[model samples]
Structure formats: structure tokens, C-alpha cells
Target: MFCGGYQVQGTIFLNPNCDPMMDAQLIGGALQGFGCDKDVLIDILTQRSSAQRIMIAEAYGSLYGRNLLEDLRENLDGHFKEVMVGLMYSPPAYDAHELWHAMKGAGTDENCLIDILASRTTSDIFQLKEVYLMQYGNNLDQDIYSETSGHFRDALINLAQGVREEGYADPGMAAQDAMVLWEACQRRTGEHKNMMQMMLCNKSHQQLWMVFQEFQNISGQDIATAIEECYDGYFQQLLLAIVSCVRDKPSYFAYRLYSAIHDFGFHNKTIIRTIVARSEIDLFTIRQRYKERYGKSLFHDLKNFASGHYEKALLAICASDGQDF
Candidate 1:
């Protein structure tokens, strides 16, 4: 259920009575004149699904002869603007944009690269590659290569290939793979990177889960613990992310949400990106996992850390329907 690629466990869904033109008109009214109606923007955009939002964006462009993203860029500011603009794009385009922003500028956001490349499904990665190429006129793998180096770059490029095995997971092969991983963890040499990369990048998530279980039996250590002890820096984080996602993606994202809130004050960008990106994917499960893992609701934490329309928009996307808490 949590394997991604149309297995949606999200808080938002397609509105049954959605009207693109009407939504566009309402957005136009909110954005017109001196001060924007932040409440209207939040209400309409947060309620609609990503597909519906796309239709609304198309309708806005046709109705007003203006680009919705650009108009939003002009009208909104700060994190709220970022969230609204993020909502306007189709998911692939938004992901491409986020990846671009992460790699652009002086220092690379390795966390962003790991978060996306490690977690997205194969089909999602393929669409992201196309969108990245079309929107930025650059190959995503090439961009990643140019920005990163060593084993970290190697892991990212491999994931970017979007060729991970899918469908039935063979238990026997998983046991063999687990032995190979155990050997790699024991050696911790240059070839260790290659072995780990091959198993982590190529195996299906289900197979990887079995491998992790086998690995624990073989080494008396969780795969995550082995990763932490054997590797360091970005490569370590990326490997950990892949394993965590394979085990429980929603729980992985819940930890991310918790980190975004608590790590060195408020990581607004991470908060916005994670919530928006996962809003239509598995944020419902993430909310439940957050409470289970941290003994508090994600909404409660967000309410404590954020305020105003920005907070309202996030809460709307992460709302629990009165049951998750």
C-alpha cells in the first residue's frame, strides 16, 4: 500500500464537485486588486486535489491570459507564496522544480536530493526526469553528477536511472542479497560501496524488506545500524533513507516532518516541501505515524511552530478528519 506510484494514502483527493473555471474565477477574484485575499487562496487551493489544481491553473491561464505561477510569485511572499506556487504545478513539475532549486546556487542541498531520489517510485522518477529535462533544458542525472561526487553521486545517479526491480520479490534471492550486504558491511572497503549500491539501487522495495530482515538475522544488526556504522556524510544519509522508505515510507516521512520542525529552529523550506509534496501521496499515513512515533499529533506540532495563513494552509493539507489524532 505504501509502495508509491498511485498508491495514494493522502489527506487530499479529487473533489467530487470540482469546477475548474469556477475555481479559476474565484482565484482571480482573490488575487485581483491591492491586497490578496489569503483566506480565499488557502480555502480553494487546499481543498482541491493536485489534478484539480492543475485544471484550475490551466483555467486561470485561459481566463486571465496570465500564468498562475508567475501571478502567484508576484502576489504572494515568504513560505505562503512558496506553498501556493508549489500547489499550482503538476506533481512532476513541482518535483523537478524542487530538485532544480536544491542543486542550484553555491552549496547543494544533499538532504533534498536524498529525500526525493531515494523515496520516489520508478514511474515517478521517470516522469520527473522528463519534466526536469523539459522545464530546465538539462538532464537530471547530469545535473546531479555535476553537483555531487564520490559514492553519494553514484547512489543518486543509480536511483535516477529509475530501473529498480519491481513486482514479485524472491525470498531466496533476498537471503543471498542479505549475505552480500553483510559482507559489504563487514569489509567497509571501496568495493563495499559498489556492493551496497547494487543491492540498494536495483532491488525492489519488497525484496529489500526481506533482505533487511535476513540481514538482521545474519549480522544481529538492523540494516540502518550497519549503514550508520559503515558510512558517513551524505552517502550514509542517502542509504539510510532508501532503507527507511522500503521499511515504512509514511513513518520515514513522519520522522522527516518532526526533524523539519525541531532541527535548528523551524526548517520552513523542509516543512513546506515535505507537507506539500506528501499531501497528495501518503501524508494521511504520515500523520498517524507521527503520533505513533512521537506521541503527539503532527498538526499539534505544526500549530505550535507556525501561525497565520501559512499555518492554516498546512493544517488544511494535514487535517486529520477528526480521527487520526
Candidate 2:
């Protein structure tokens, strides 16, 4: 149900029986924002299933005078814009979010860069870079260069430029790498770094899990244990979350936030800041998972840790979304 975040109602799809091209014409007219039928727009677009949305988008392109994407841009803003963009643009939203995370911090979120750039399809990612350039008016590579330095930055930037294979990762090969990482960790050798940097950098959580299980069987050590022995601080936390995301992301993040607050004494500013930033993305799904695992609402947990306008802002974004503003 929850692909990444945001609650999706399955009925919001296009009518399977409807003529898709005609549907696009009607839908695009409603979404036009120039005295368009807001009621019709809301009824049709809001109820559209993901597949329907995709069809409508296609129809808008094929049958309409203008792009549906351009129309959405004219009307939607903030969080609503994000939701519309996610459904309209598809996988690029994931890359956009990844780029957002990579650029948001005081320093670059290189982990995000490595994970997203190396894992995504080259064509999709290349298009995403162009979108970033068009939207932000600065080259994505230039931004990456500004955020980091040296070989690590170059490696990340190179990946972002999409010179690598187009999602050409082999699951069988990944499984072998996972085993290498586990074995190298046991050997107390530098090779562990290479294996982990590769595995954690690319590879989906699902693929990683398969490889991880194989790695564990071959070497009696879980990915978490390997990370603990090999890395530290935020990188360590990121790796642990990546490994656990396959199983239970909500619990993993909840555990991390709790530990950071209770044991490490992270300031309220830091806690609220991180939670607020992620609320629009990971927090929605994380909340669902947190509720399932701990029988407590994420909103409630967040309230316990935060207060005042900051709390309201985070809660508001999570509940009603940012577009309501």
C-alpha cells in the first residue's frame, strides 16, 4: 500500500473502461487552473488510482494542447505539489528527494548521494539531473562539487552524471559482494570498506537483504554487526538503517531518534529539525510502522519530544500535508 510515503487510495485510478485519450483531455482541462472546474478536477484527479493518474498524464500529453505537468505546476504548491509531482513524474520524485537530502545539510549527505545515484536507472537519473538544473537553475554536478571534495565527491558526482550502467546491477553479483563485505569485516582488512561502500552505496534494501542473508550464512555475522565493527557516527547510523529498512524502517528510525535523544542528549533543535525534514518523506510510512510495532502513534511520540510551533508544524505537515498551507 505504502510505496514510499503518503497514503494512497486505490480508487483514485482512471476508469479502466474509459477512453484514456479522452480522459486526458477532460482531466487536463479541469487541471488548467484558468477558471477550470475545480470540482471536476478534485473529483477526477483526487480519486484517480496511480495507474489512472499515469494514464491521464499520458493522455494529457497526447491529446491536450499543453502538458499536464505544466498545468500542475501552475496550480499546485508546497506539499500538495510534492504529492502531485510524485504521482505525475513517477520515479524521478525519488531522485529529487534524494537530491534534496543530499543538498539540504550543512555538508552534503554523501550517503544519500551514493545510495540514490548508484542505484537508480541511468536514464531516469539523467533526466532527474536535468530537472534539477531546470528547476534550480544550477547544474546538479556543480552543487555536488560545492557540497563535497576530493575522490569521494568525484565518485559521487561521476555517479550522478550517470556514466555508469542503467540500473544494471546483478542481484547475483550483489549477493557475492555482500558476502565479501561480511568476510572482509571478519578478517580485519581494508577490503571490508570497499565491499560495504559498494553494497550500502547502491543496491535496494530487498536485494541487499538477499545478499545479506547469504553473507550471514557464509560468515556468521549480520550486516549490523559488520557496520558496528567497521564504521561509526552518522555513517554507522545510516548503514544500520539501510540494513534494517528491509525489515522495519519505522522501528529502526524510532530507535535511532530515541537513542539520540535519551542517551546521546541531542538538543531539541536537532531532533525537531530532523523529524520535520523527514516528515514529508519517510515519516508518514515510518509512523505507520511505528504504530504497528510499538502501539504508539508517531504523532504522539513526536509530541512527546517537541513542542510549540515546531511541533505543530511537523504534525501539520504529517497530517494535512504542507500544501494545505
Task: Tell me, by lDDT, which candidate is best.
Answer: 1
**Quality of model 1 by C-alpha lDDT:** 0.89
For each candidate in the order shown, give its overall lDDT on alpha carbons: 0.89, 0.57
lDDT of 1 by residue, 203-252 (tens): 99988989999999989999999999999999999999999898889888
How many clashes show up in model 1? 0
Q: How do the predictions measure up, each by TM-score?
A: 0.96, 0.52
List, residue by residue over 11-99, the lDDT tens digit for candidate 2. Answer: 12234565667767777666655554544544444444445667778877777667787787777654334444444544454466557
After superposition, the stretches of candidate 2 with alpha carbons farther than 4 Å from their true spots are 2-128, 149-175, 186-192, 233-238, 248-284, 292-295, 305-310, 320-325
Reference-based TM-score, model 2:
0.52
Candidate 2 has its poorest 10 consecutive residues by lDDT at 4-13
> Which candidate tops TM-score?
1
